[model samples]
Target: MANKVYNFSAGPSVLPEQALKEASAACIDFENSGISILSMSHRSKPIENMFAQTEQYLRELMGIPEDYDIVFLGGGCSLLFCMLPMNFLDQNATADYALTGVWANKAYKEAKQFGNALAACDTKSETYSRIDKNLKLSDNATYLHVTANNTIYGTEWHNFPKPKSGFLMADVSSDFLARKINVSDFGVVYGGAQKNISCAGVTVTIIKKGLLGKVNRTIPTMLNFQTHIDAANMFNTPPVFAVYVMNRTLKWLKDFGGVDAIEKVNRSKAALLYSALDNSKVFVGTAAKEDRSIMNVPFVFNKDVVAADKADDLAKEFLEFAKARGLQQLKGHRSVGGFRASIYNAMPVEGVQALVDCLGDFEKKVLG
Candidate 1:
């Protein structure tokens, strides 16, 4: 067994050990306030300070503009699927979605409930192996929504599409803060905190204030983005502990040289695994080389090495073998039926090397 285990789950995945340690201490006595962070009141001074710090850290890390408002809410990313259209899709314009993967498709479906929704570009026919650079949308499009990273299919938009008319909204759930991005390029950017940032229970949204109140229909108080923004993300009781942990994680990220430095490291880690896959005789990458995600690398046992009929059994065997060696959560999404190694920002390079070694060892055993 390896000396230490490395987690590679797609969501609710690995986080910085130091951040976890700090959070652990805060859980007992937050900021010496004589109460656990989990028990701290959302309306307290400490919690308010944490919220400001969290937003500031995010703004500094992502270069979010002053015109944008950052809000942390309780519902997961899926809830935003409905909330987005409710708040932004107008009666006269259509909500256009780039269907890159399952999540994008889900968002597009939700948009339909509000008004005219269009599938601007759908790659499902291609098994979502690649992202389309061009999208089909009419002149009256309200917004063009794109999923920046598709964790399930192991694809990412290396180059963002520029809409000729409407603003771009991105669901960056899987790749948030993994690399540097121009926050100004999108009208709204949102993601669940569990993937690359922190823990579950909090969803972060960065939206341009001008985009709100444009839809013709009235949105419910909670579904309205302006409500959270106007209330300073304290419309109701906030997810206190999750946001606190996120603040610590962001601090860790900043101390680790922020997104730019981490992007280089993330790319290096991904290259190590992708290079191994490229040279392997028994494994093949699922996503296209050009559109491959640096965070989630999904590969399958080569059909030549293991016949199609036996691929599932081989995958099962490989997962067990990997887990026994302390390489955990190496299984792919159920939809894909292969192996997905989600090497998020917190994953160390040594972990990737260990997984590479396991791949080689497993290939030898399978061949024998």
Candidate 2:
């Protein structure tokens, strides 16, 4: 279809059409109960069964252990940043953070209000181009925090870090389920679902059972992990619509053979697009080669390195060209002026190939 443009949106990125189709059906009549999933009581049996099955599917897909409790909560990863310290950090100790990008830096700063917060390592000097695996932590550090992927900088931690003495926590907002990861590597793994899971209403938190009830501070009921855990993510009215859609997406993931299969497709998509970027005379990747993200490829049209002209004329031309031909949202973040193509789990290889073909066409038109 001429209207079927490739979506390169960073997040709330792309979802499987199958999931959307199924969710549309559920919205009208879920499980043939004649009760719309949107209107169903949170305590209703069907919703409970659906929610429980969704969690189970996630567990099987990720190989998450029994000791880890997965809760679909609200407020996204931003709220988790504050709640993590409130529920875990002790008054006498500091929490260490690897400051790789904006979100990580925000998390470390937020933790400062709860207790001693230390930036163990930061790539700010390097323009957040790469991850620093080697880190320095306080002897009494309560936990080590890191962001698994930098959406804005287009860098990723291919090698996850392990804390030497304390709990390891990750903010995996951008790349959840895009690859295979050992759940046991971190004491807590959490992210906002908008990027790859589903729409923006839910935040999934996977926490080791032992990590809760350790902080000395008196935490608010809403901010406590124990509250959500005890209530099974129903301490309050859950985001019914968002969760229903997410459950549907999880089913699609399972049908597509889960994370392993999706990761393979993701790798192939990224490789195809990146191969095009690396070979183009006008486009230049912004991230360090080894740390480049497989999910989000950020690049710039280098007028200086390729052709002498107005600084951003070629970039503008290519954006218009791609948009007219069914390739869309290839623009980068406002802070970083360039192009970023996010090929998440659901973005098909055809979408990526379309963008790659656009790049090739643009290069041929401009250079010759």
Candidate 3:
């Protein structure tokens, strides 16, 4: 990790060192097989076993019930934005959405093209500082859709909503494996395997087996979740290398003591960064206190100071300062700019400590 600065980029983010080594070996010569994973046949037993292992590892880690089937599909959550409604949203019914962040808003917008997509509640007016736990939803709606974690604004649903009405679907892309979850609570939970899982190629969809096939429509083969399930995640040739790397990442998580262990570390990392932000006179945490994300920490420097009018300039100065101190990807998202330090499951406590140290040092030097 000498040349590598502590990677805090949101997606396609940092992965475990052990997982990386194994993935590199698989790319060259996979398990003594003559071909690399890139060239491996999807129908081959190696590929089949790889997919099986990945699902199994994930199921075990998340304690997914037997009723749920974990399938790896080609497109990212962006594709799912439309495909999800195509299969689930009925033309006559409404799809309830909790617009807590940008992606959630996008999902709701996508659903509207399909049918009546209702915004049960939205926080966009307030820049999505918080989550509305008491969501006004209809029990007769098709399903309640929510993004489990918002990477851009650094707000997360520490407690995922359990809607009494209709089915519950979540896009837990950023915080997929960072903490333990009650899998039985959701009807369908999906995420892109780029942030906490693996590189950008596959999307993992864990849908309750019975909940599918209920949408009244002639669903296309590719867009339908049941199609992928029926094919055992082999429809149209899965992303072999991505699934393999994700399997390795899952294995690393297990070796590192599973979700329970990682959650403690994740909380610690969040606490470290949040503590620094709270103590700093030059930095203010943007996310709501109770709804702050453990995965993404977005902070603004000196928002209340006399130089607040020059906030952008001060932010740039601090960004460059932190970059010089070996903290990379400290720039915040374009929609909400200041700085965002995404500490995923792979980000060790030491990396967060280094970032916290940078925050303290920058505040003392720039503020004083």
Best by lDDT: 1
- What does candidate 3's lDDT look like per residue over 1-368, in tens digits? 34448889998899999999999998888889978888888899988988899989998999998989888887797998898888888788888899999999888888998889998888888899888888988878878998988899888887877776788899999999888888888888988989999999999888887777777889888888888888898878888999988999999999999999999999999998999889888788999999999999998765566265788777788888878877889899987878899999999888999998888887778757
Name the Cα RMSD for model 1.
1.1
**Rank ordering of all candidates by lDDT, starting from the highest:** 1, 3, 2
Better of 1 and 3 by TM-score: 1
Clashing pairs in 3: 282-302
Model 1 spans > 4 angstroms off: none
Of the candidates numbered 2 and 3, which has the greater lDDT value? 3
lDDT of 2 by residue, 117-197 (tens): 999898898878888878987777778998998999989989887776788899888999989989888899999998888
Q: Candidate 3, residue 188: CA error in Å?
A: 0.4
Instruction: Give the lDDT of residue 81 in candidate 1.
Output: 91
Once model 1 is optimally superposed onto the true structure by TM-score, how far is the C-alpha of residue 129 displaced, in angstroms?
0.9
What is candidate 1's local distance difference test score?
Answer: 0.91
Instruction: For candidate 3, give the lDDT.
Output: 0.87
Q: After superposition, how far is residue 305 of candidate 2 from its true place, in Å?
A: 4.1
Go through the candidates in order and give each one's C-alpha lDDT.
0.91, 0.86, 0.87
